[model samples]
Target: MAFDGKLLANLSVLAAVVESGNFARAADALGLTASGVSRAISRMEARLGIRLLHRTTRSITLTDEGERFYAEVRPLLVGIEEAASHAGGASLSVRGRLRVNVDPLFSRHVLAPRLPEFMARHSDLEIELITRDDLGDIIGEGVDVAVRFGFPPSSSLVARQLLETRIITVASPAYLKKHGHPCTPADIASHTCIQFRDSQTRRPFDWEFHKGRKVVPVTTHGPLLVSDAGTLMSVCIAGGGLAQMMAIGVVQDHLARKKLVQVLPDWADERFPLYAFYPSRHHPAAKVRSFIDFCLEILA
Candidate 1:
């Protein structure tokens, strides 16, 4: 097909439909009628001699061919939009939907409280945040950026280090008073320890501690194993057990109020690095770049 204004318009419509999940929603997003959007998609399919979507009365899904085609065209569409915005000199006016995937603990404790400021700064941008502990397939899930803990594996996406926070072992003051504080990592075996399980792997996270250039991984048994850091913090606050958690997840007010006490402070030398990951940036969207810079500034 020859590259022209009409072809670009139709491609834009196709991208919107796939992103929004329905013709009506895509039309609303693009300031077109539902019938107009549907006609454009039908025209494209007829021209290409391929069905792009499997549609029913209630829902619509991409066909296998549609998925591959979208993957190939989506980045090109983004590049075109960026080029157009630069041509018009509208780079400062960042406006679009930004989908983010974040760890549950980071979402609740670190990002959630600070989101109002970010939204206020970029009033034109729309945000959709999905919080999960496990690292999902970012490209397949249509995530613009993902905030994750620990080191991410090598992948197609670009990874930038946000920050590293210390992991502290903590328990309620009442529990520590009743059970006595642990003097060494080995002493945890005699006390109640709270555990966190990997949501994707279904395996408990090993409690790591460092002392004088040596790192140790301790296996702990607990009455409760949780997949969420917030819930694990709550259990620990109620004197359920000891928990090893990132400093970002620890409530400073709780520590000041003596609701939670840091145990093994000398041994709390392990640090976990947080990263913001996104797709390749041959032509990075303004919305994604702006949001990432905003987060880095806030977290700095």
Candidate 2:
């Protein structure tokens, strides 16, 4: 048999059903009725001569054959999407549904502020930003792009460095006045220091301060521990304890406003990197390219 356009169309419906985990949601996304979605799947099953999904009244799961087929189909779908976006020349193939996995801090403090301008520039683009603490199976979750802080561990995805944010040690004025400011990096061990939990390790990261050519590690002990950057900032601002924070972005505003004062500036030479990751580097979709460029502009 030759190629059939209807079969190609059904692939998207299948993708939507598997991604959304239900026919009703898949139908809504594709602008079809639930019964219509059911009919389309039935047609696909008949043409393929295999049950792709183990369907119950309440749930849907892929059969072993369907699992293997879907693995191959995912890459094909991604290629089709990228090709569609590049149909037009280099004027930015920015027209498409862009799925982004964004770090919470960057989403709230950086991207959210400039979103209106970005959307205005690309009227054809539709953005779906998912803000979370960790990057999990972007390909499986259908994420087109992801932005995160720190160096990404080894991965097959292309990670582009967006910025190297300066790191600073800071504490509120009242807290410093009561506890007395530390004079050197080693003195930090005697002072209460905020602790941040590493997402992958689930262990509190050791506090470190950097200077000209020296890196000093200070064992930190604090009354509180937190996973969220916002919570860390909040407690530090309330005169709770000393914290190490980024010197750029909303984090810097506290320093400028005098709500928080930099401590041990001599050891504040450390920098944390931020990166934007995507599945492919070759002929990336216009949406991915445009969004990354937008991030570079704002973070600049």
Give the number of the best model, judged by lDDT. Answer: 2
Cα lDDT of model 1 by residue, 1-300, tens digit: 565787778999999898898999999999999999999999989877899999999888889998898899899999988987664543456677789999887888888988998899888889999988777898998998898887877788898898998888999988998999999998988888988886656988888888768897887888788888878888999999899888874566688788999988889788889998998766567777887887788788
Q: For every model shown, what is its TM-score relative to the native structure?
A: 0.70, 0.71
List per-candidate RMSD values in Å. Answer: 14.8, 15.1
lDDT of 1 at 263: 87
Each model's backbone clash number:
0, 0
